[model samples]
Target: MARFVLVSDTTLSRNYRSVPLLDFLASAPTDALPNAIYSFLKGPPPPAAEGRAALAPYAVRKLEASLLKHYSKDEVVVAHEDHISEFIDEDTEVIGVSTMDPLGLGPLTMSYAVFFETRAHAYVQREFESLLARINKARSGKKAKLLVGGPGVWELTVRPEELDRNKIDFAFQGEADDIAGDLFRYVSDDSGEKTEFFRGYQTFNANFRKEWEPNPKFISRYQFSKQFPALEEIPDIVNPSVKGMVEVMRGCGIGCDFCEVTLRPLRYYSPERVRREIEVNVRSGQSNAWLHTDEVFAYQHGRHYVPNEEALLDLLRAVMSTPGITRTNPTHGRISIPAAYPDLMKKMSSIMGAGRNNWIGLQVGIETGSDRLASTHMPNKTLPLKVGPDGSWSDIVWRGTYVMNKHYWRPAFTVQVGQAGETPEDNWDTVALINRMSNSSLDNGLPFEFTVTPMQNVPLGLLKSRDFDSVKLDQSQLAVYYASYRHLAKMAARDATSASSDTNVAARYVTGALVGVGGWVMFQQVKSICRKGGLDLEKAARHGLSERPQVPSIAVIR
Candidate 1:
């Protein structure tokens, strides 16, 4: 039997506990055919399996189907680095390296110290070098082919010269599930034309199939589990509700110039399928459900969007009617619904006890208020104002608070900014929008907690096209945006202070405005230097926001 070995750059010990990579490799159907599989998980396994159960059933199902179809189950083996050499015998025919890289999307933690302290890019490079060293050592007298795949290998930053120097035989982008079959066919061939035969082997198509199988169990077990590994560790405030977490769809149709979700074709799960999954989770003792999707309202089956108003209402009624489960005391405490479609928002609010102390909250992507800037940059998002009668935008804060006060007695919202293709005009519009929202919140007597996340775009795949220039922060733009943000923050602070006492109202407002203006001046200074340095606005923003460590030491890999 042909022997194959799989190696991952990720610390297997730290990240792969619930549905370990070895589990997938071990489940492959290699023995039924002519192969023997041995998988080695490099690095530390993940801490715990606390949060993995939250992934929707549909995702988990897909992952399992793919694994079973590829490699033989009994033929597979798993080990760490210390035992890697023991598995690499002369019979080994292929060595596959599963390398993943961080996409430079800021720190996983919001803490500034952790953000700058972690060198994700450097960590990736070291991992690659280490894998190459292992491959070279294992190559003693065996004629095994070396294969590399994963997120890190697909980077525009990785130069061809580096690959050439390392002498990697082949690299797979996106997915590597089908690589084993192709490698098996190539190695088993007696003809010396093995290279020629393998050159045309369908790596991309095979990998895609292996990656996109429709097993709900696999998707539930892998991605979701890994994303929130320790389920039990989560605070009760954020714990799963009675219904449990369920994914309504996958992928997004909106091709926001700055976003990555648009790169893949959008595929949605059916409402009927969603209902079935919900029932499964409830039966399995899950209380709350968070519907996961890039755009929840975009879910369409065949000719129509599933759970369109009437259908969603029916689904909610059915859940509420489930014996012994009250709509108010749902097994799943809260459902985090997306505000992509205003109609969906209205429907969700109406059925889930809108304008009351309801457990559900809506997440709307109000990227910016400026119609022109939003249209140019994030065209995929339907502007609230652009939708209704006479171009009237929805009062999100008011509605959010209304719902919270009526149902759950808590107000929550998430606001995102710093899209990849944002321009000076776009930034100005964002500033204006923030100010307007903050003011509106106070005027309407709404208690809302706004999370302002400033994310700089990273160039990747098709998005690396030359049409969109990278944003570099110039002194002027920086000054303007910072001033605008500070102005809004001060306004919020003043509003809070005013609601308490009237004496410091004037002083607080004046001080806030002055601090905002001063920040603007500093921004101008930085802009002038950026212009002299011939930097692009996007690039400048990345440099300014990137956490640059003082000593430039490599991250301490555990």
Candidate 2:
């Protein structure tokens, strides 16, 4: 029997019809989104090949590669979720599961919970529980130690009771590429000094500083910088990853006060390293390279966070030169780069072959539009451009969107409400920014293409207490939600049909129809919720339209 069997939570295994951003559907409450629709959106599970997953999530694949460095191929198996039972036998010593948002306490999941006023478990949490039940059942007679890791492990740290509730032996809290071999050995042996690992997980205080507390059920890196794997220490994937996903870098140095990613030291992957991973995905018939990073602009950055234009271009060139990469886009980036460097945006778009038929999708965290909040929370996000000298934070975002849309790039923006020191006016500024962008058109007369999602700034105390129902959206927060959904419905109706990547024409049309209809229905529900919360819908719809300035397009600026 395989000694190490790695798997990811079920929510991460599906292809999601190859539609961009459809994976977010798992964050919705299982009660709110019927299982039929969820399954249809997630598409079929990856085909099982000899009881092994045909494709696994990128993180699980990374762990598998790490384990392979110390174990034989037959001793390590990346089991498909449905076929996990086939791999677990009497000799299995460790079963490692990686997940994201296992408890539905993530920002988006919590936002839905608070806005919808439902305590129902999100599809992510539901799937994780179901997977654990299956795993526990299969390993009943065996001595396989269950170890959970990944971004979602932090949630378990917040709610330690879940370790006992789910029958998990240990929850690893940090990146394990450097220590995977020893970690597995430690668990398998079950007796050691434990000097290499911290028995507790790391958490952030109210001011967002790192803090560690004792917990026998959790383990974190003893020394973060020393334990974080270096660029050469990390390994390339030996198996195909879902979504053609590959990491170009490890940390975001933008240092947003509210973000934890900044706390980790930056480690960039060389272009050769990136190309090798893309080649692995290409062999699996994945043509689209989804580059994963906290901030694409920070890759090989120059002083003061100014994007290294040449390095960025070289990276895209490496991706495009891959044998089967038809399209490419980074997972996250800051808008300030596009605002401050239009030529670079055009150059990168050309490298990626972005145009009307192939719009590059990017996720940008435009947390708030108010200059006060932007400067207060994420001062470095506006690097290379001062808020007052360049323009307001919203102005920078507007110019960035203008530049991106001109080059056929659609940004999926995420805004936050209920910040630590936020006032109603701060939220109104966010509404105004969304309205202004929604009503504005491109230089080519095409309406600006983008989608905005409002996420609640949920506190750790609330999440740990599992008191999500006690959270309520005030009038201003509700206005942000209404404004956000209003624009989302428009984008869905306009782009859903064309955005699908499904090979079957009939399936694509069906998926598009459902998406369009679902958008309208969800907006109606959001409207009702806002009205009950005493928000003025009409005012929100027209918040900044009248004051939108006719700024010159970025094409002529530089």
Candidate 3:
């Protein structure tokens, strides 16, 4: 038996059929989606060899690598969820699980709960509970300590009692790349010394400010400087990660008031470091590189949040030049960068070999379309391009989408509802933006290739009480949801067949068909909900079509 066993929640272990953005399906409420379909869509778990997962989530892989620096390969095991029992025995000193959105109170998960009007646990929460049950069962008579950590650990801090309910010994917060060995030893030995660590977790306020509260179930770095590991301190993954993921950067410097990612200091990985990590994934038969970052454009950025085009280009070139990398794309970025630097986007697209058949997908947080909200919540998001001087927030987004589609980049946008000081008109603005973008096309007559997902800003108090039904979506909010779903349904019907990554022809076709039909059916439900909520679907259908911008002539490869 291994001394330290690490695993990730089931949702993060699968490939989601390798379809872009399909991973979001795991956030759907258990009561809303059927089990048969969910299981099919999530695909099979990663292959295991002697109870060890061949590919694990990137976060768990990082933790595993950190432990390996001190522990021998035989002493540490990254176990598959199904075979965790095989690794746990009396000698096992600690069982570490990495999770994202374990409690399902995350913005996207809560969005579904509020929209669906159900308090049922999301698939994430359900799978986490089930995994905990399995772990507890495996370690029933053993002396192993259950340690849960990762980005989702914050949810546990919000509901600290869950630590006891789940039989978790400690929920660690913040980055532990530099101190993983110390942390493991502390947990394994049940240390009471608070010299390098604290006995509490950190919380963020409405303004995204950090606060600490005393809690024995939680452990975190004592000093803020210790929360983020410097570039030299962080170690590379020794194994392949799910989706061929490799971290390119650590924090987003945009400083969006509503975001906590901005709190961490920025750290960029050199192009050489990035390529080394990609090589590890390639050795495991992954040809596509998924660069993980809070903001891709912020890599080695200049003053005033200006994008360093040369740095970004070098990074892309390095990724593509890797031995087995056939494609590459960043995880997240801001729209204003693409809007203000079209030439840079075109150059990067050429380097990545992007085209109609090879669309590059990115997740962007265009939280709101209203300029008032944009200026108030995330003024720095539009750094290089001022809202009034360059264009309205919607206009900037429109031009950015146009440029991206022209260069074969499809950004997945997330908009938020119920933000601080949000008004009905703000939601209507969002609906109008979605309608206009959905109706616009590229120079090659291809529809704008992108997706818009609506997220809810659930208050902490409500999240703790599980009183989601009390937070109802008004008519305008329902309109935003309707408009977003309408556009998503159209995109699904058009791109599902082409975007699927399954190698088997028959399986790919079936998966595409299911995805397309599922989108239409989901949109129908949204339409019914909107009709019952007193939203004017017809009016929403034509909300911003009258103001659709004319497509400018541009040489773009289809």
Per-residue CA lDDT of candidate 2, range 93-176, in tens? 999999999999888988899999899999999999999999999999789999999999888988999999999999998889
User: What's the true lDDT of residue 280 in model 3?
Assistant: 94
Query: What stretches of model 1 exceed 4 Å from their correct place?
Result: 1-64, 76-169, 174-247, 257-260, 271-291, 301-307, 310-366, 383-422, 435-446, 458-472, 475-558
- What TM-score would candidate 3 get against the native? 0.97
Clash pairs, candidate 3, are none
Off by over 4 Å in 2: 223-225, 547-558
Q: Which ten residues in a row have the lowest lDDT in candidate 3?
A: 549-558
User: How do the predictions measure up, each by TM-score?
Assistant: 0.49, 0.98, 0.97
* Ranking of all predicted structures according to lDDT, beginning with the best and ending with the worst: 2, 3, 1
Tens digit of lDDT per residue, candidate 3, span 173-282?
A: 98999999999899998868656888898897765667888888888987564578888989999999988999999988798887788888899999999999999999
| Deviation (Å) of 471 in candidate 3 | 0.5
Q: At residue 244, what lDDT does model 2 achieve?
A: 89
lDDT of 3 at 393: 86
- Scored by Cα lDDT, where does model 1 land? 0.39
